[model samples]
Target: MADTVADLLIDRLIDWGVDTVFGLPGDGINGLFESLRRRQDRIKLVQVRHEEAAALAACGYAKFTRRLGVCLATSGPGGLHLVNGLYDAKSDGQPVLAITGHTYHDLIGTRYQQDVDLERVLGDVAAYSERVMSASHVCNVVDEAVKTAIARRTVAHITVPKDIQDWPSSGPRSKANVARHSGDLYADAMPLPPQSALQKAADLLNSGSRVAILAGRGCLTARKELLAVAEKLGAPIVKALLGKAVVPDDHPLTTGGIGLLGTAPSQEVLEGCDRLLIAGSSFPYLEFYPRPNQARAVQIDLDPSRIGLRYPVEIGLTGHCWDVLRGLLPLIEDKSDRSFLTQAQQRMAQWNELMETRATRNDLPMKPQVVARTLNEFLQDDAVICCDTGTVTTWAARHILIRGAMEFSASGTLATMGNGLAYSIGAAVAFPGRQVVCFAGDGGLTMLMGELATIAKYRLPVKVIVIKNNQLGMIKWEQLAFEGNPQYGVQLQPIDFAGVARACGVPGWHLADPRLARGVLKEAFDQPGPALVEAEVDPNEPPLPGKLTTDQAWQFVKALAKGQPDRWDIIRTVVENKIREVV
Candidate 1:
């Protein structure tokens, strides 16, 4: 029933349940776009301002929907622009399919207009990368690319020559031996760990009186099982940033997030526990984990390679988080002494109090923490929250309370900037019925400011909150904390983001006074369509870690002594923040 190679490709994707695609249009991909135009009623294309936003939006779609997210781009520069987003998908283990156009077969090596080796250039980021050489190869290549991306939870790429896209659809050659593929592949069966392996993990968990459980993104669907296991062991739950919504922030046993943008309670629990159980998370920070050989550890992960990747474990169970946790539930015995859990709950309470005090501060220049906290108050129960990389990440991790069915994600492993708005756009496209919000820093928003027009074009009701601090807050702290040097090359020029949003036809608000934050945020969220709020926050407020090392303290002193421009202001704010905990 398909007329051309492009038509066949689109039909195959629709058969695989792909209802939407994120892309930018160009001449090289015009044939494919024409096919999309013809079948506009069946599949929709959410055109973006830049190819990079398209790819990032695809990554966001895959993260939120747990399905294959597809992105299309033209040849040469447009195709190359997808690399950064593809790397984000690869690093975070999300399923994404990237389709690119190539120069004509004869013009490939002649350096014709927009001539680039797309397949070769994309090889590093994709699990499967191939070029469609003929019309007969389109069906098989598209099928394989989708199947590989879904099964491996990684990026897959396909490059079709511009000329070949319009060729008449054809079957495999009849004269020679050839193979055909079908688009009805199913690869979502849940794998359970071997009974013996589960028993080993259970025995290790049961042996210790002081137990702590660390959960990650993989545990999103295993919340009930994770809580059951924790309750049985009287273990405190410590979540990684990606796993923020795995357990509610108000849960009694949860110690909040772990690592630099984490809580003191989580750090204490990991350090004091005699036994550790890591479920579905390969948290990369080794320093945040228990010291080597300090505790007997058991890890459960779908991928065997990631079982002991972060910490040494006595037993490793390879299986889906829900499957493995469900199996181990019956074997784990309940702890009679609730002392460890009690102490962790107490620390969590104190940490929450300290955080509340910080969030309530009415500083002359607004504190970023207050913005995140205020946004959290107005969030819908099931809001999908997207955060960018930088100081905004710290505030979101610390202040935003993930409750009900809310979902939170970012460029976790990639730690790339400029993805907040793109991810929010993808969320808005995928689920128009749900409330979507983005927390972006000044730098990250500046990187992808063009996407605001995309939001206006779609008229999606996404709330954009920009922490308008005129500096790269994260890099400034990193320079002082890690490099023991004063900040340099991190300052950013001030921009009226709200004014820019208004120019793009979205309702906008500028909030510089702390007293007007809640009211302005309410007005922005009340808008029926896309809206943005620019909160001008203080740049001197540092994003202090949960537990500061002595060397880091010495480095902070060194940087201050070396004459930072705002050293005195920074010291004053740090003392004021620290005083909240003691008082």
Candidate 2:
């Protein structure tokens, strides 16, 4: 077969060990699509309903596999649709490669059909963006794009003109491109910090009796070392949402997630600690962090700019999570005191008990917490779960316990809707053998409802659990949290997501009664292919934060006093639920 530009790029992708490509077929890239078809055996192109989903899938694939995920789209609007998902990957520091199509080379600035500048379009979201001028530049551009994405842990963009894609390849393939890097290629290898930095961290930790560790996604690979450092310091650990599963939820020292979607115990641990160790996380919520001078901090991260960006730090140790923690463990003194850990454990236990009570309630309108707990009961040790950003995030954070080898992913920084199903599809494609699940709110699920067809088409066994509250639950809560206002524009008509899933050729179940949740969820999980379970939940049940300030309390009371039909009933139910926490 003659070597076309598409052939060169496809061959390079194969050489880079990319076995799959998430993309959509469009008129702008008919030539590229033809080449994809020719090389279909080597690289499977996952056809998605929309270009946005394609980009999100690539992000999801990279997040789970720790490799450079690849996605393709046609010119103009197709490339434009990829911006949101690319931003999600870029914001969260995931490595991804985006290939977009453009018009013929001669029509570059003629105002022809689909002739937008691809470089400028993706410039903000991509660390490396380039256009293929000739067949000779194919290998170098594609190779460098992939390399830069891996080395910098960011997105790389390549736009190939429709005509150029059909040209024969004559580009040079460097030895660097052929040689594969061992271990984790997604993240650049970072060296340990200086001895003085490690010693300073150790000194601060030893001097403070109450030490706390805030672990994030960067600590994913350093679980053992992170735990070792925590144990040596006699500290309780608080997790950033992205780092929720860094250490299992049930770990004695763990207080679950901190900040808005966090537990009470995690807040207590943060407020009570005298020394804070931030490992591999740039948790953006400054209010959730301890005030300056209240607790001294030592931040360990690979990026120097990010070291003290999130919180005020006395010492910044720029290095990999494992390297910094491993180096500091030897220098740190083991603390004999256990009061801090003991108090944290007690508070966590109380919080856990309250959560269990709420989650186990077989109330008429099913509790969303129960949906997560029931799903958790049926999940495998190696299950991969993707959560949408909203109220469902709260349920997943508090109810789902990360145990064994489970992998949890979400839109951490971007926090976009319509990502749950797309992410699950990518995870399913990346690890077909592993069980995949998506926890989404009704609002989010409806936004990308078309992905159900993709799931069914591929026979990807992704179980979707939609928390059908018939409203934008998170936004509704936000209004109450920020100001005492009656809900507006947040109400959603109840949706039959299960029926929609069935229409897409995926089996589904709708659970209105909480009593049937366990059995129906199990049945859905047992299905050999894609399945969706929509559980109607209490819309008024607020997702309370770990701590409520005086102003927030006032806002809540004012919102109730505005006199909606069920305002008093909602207040009563909320008070009753709070009373259960103490009783």
Q: Which candidate has the highest TM-score of all? A: 1
TM-scores for all predictions: 0.98, 0.96
How much RMSD separates candidate 1 from the native structure? Answer: 1.2
lDDT (tens digit, per residue) of candidate 2 on 380-433: 988998999899999999999998888998999899999999999899999989
Give the runs in model 2 whose Cα sits over 4 Å from its true position: 170-189, 563-566
Candidate 1: give the clashing pairs.
none
Candidate 1 Cα errors over 4 Å, as ranges: 171-180
Q: Which lDDT value does model 2 have at 151?
A: 79
Error of 2 at 17 (Å): 1.6
How far in Å is the alpha carbon of 309 misplaced in model 2? 0.7
What C-alpha lDDT, on a 0 to 100 scale, does residue 259 get in candidate 1?
94
Looking at model 2, which ten-residue stretch has the lowest summed lDDT?
A: 178-187
| Model 2, residue pairs in steric clash | none
Question: Deviation in angstroms for 450 in model 2?
Answer: 0.8
Whole-model lDDT, model 1: 0.92
